[model samples]
Target: YIDFYNNNRIHSALGYLTPAEYYQQSILQNVA
Candidate 1:
């Protein structure tokens, strides 16, 4: 359930991205 919430569910507040996707994008942006 937790995994599905973070990795599969899309969130409008995060621009329709899953929480995991949003976090990964932010990490990559910071690394670059």
Candidate 2:
């Protein structure tokens, strides 16, 4: 369930991205 929430579910607050997706994007942005 935790994995589903973080990696599979899409969140409106995160611009329709899953938490994992959002985190990855943030990390890329910070690195660049």
Candidate 3:
């Protein structure tokens, strides 16, 4: 599923985090 890939699939280029996960974590880091 699209949601699964964007929010759950791991990508090595992203340190094994999904695209959505990486984006969310980055945003949180930026805000802190």
Model 3 regions more than 4 Å off: none
Error of 3 at 29 (Å): 0.6
Count of clashes in candidate 1: 0
Off by over 4 Å in 2: none
- Give, for candidate 2, the lowest lDDT window spanning 10 residues: 1-10
- Highest TM-score, which number? 2
Q: Find the 10 residues in a row with the least total lDDT in model 3.
A: 1-10
TM-score of 2: 0.89
Quote each prediction's TM-score.
0.88, 0.89, 0.71
Count clashing residue pairs per candidate. 0, 0, 0
Residue 10 of model 1 has an lDDT of: 94
lDDT tens readout by residue for model 1, 1-32: 99988999999999999999999999999999
Q: What C-alpha RMSD separates each model from the true structure?
A: 0.5, 0.5, 1.1
lDDT (Cα, tens digit) per residue for candidate 2, span 1-32: 89977999989999999999999999999999
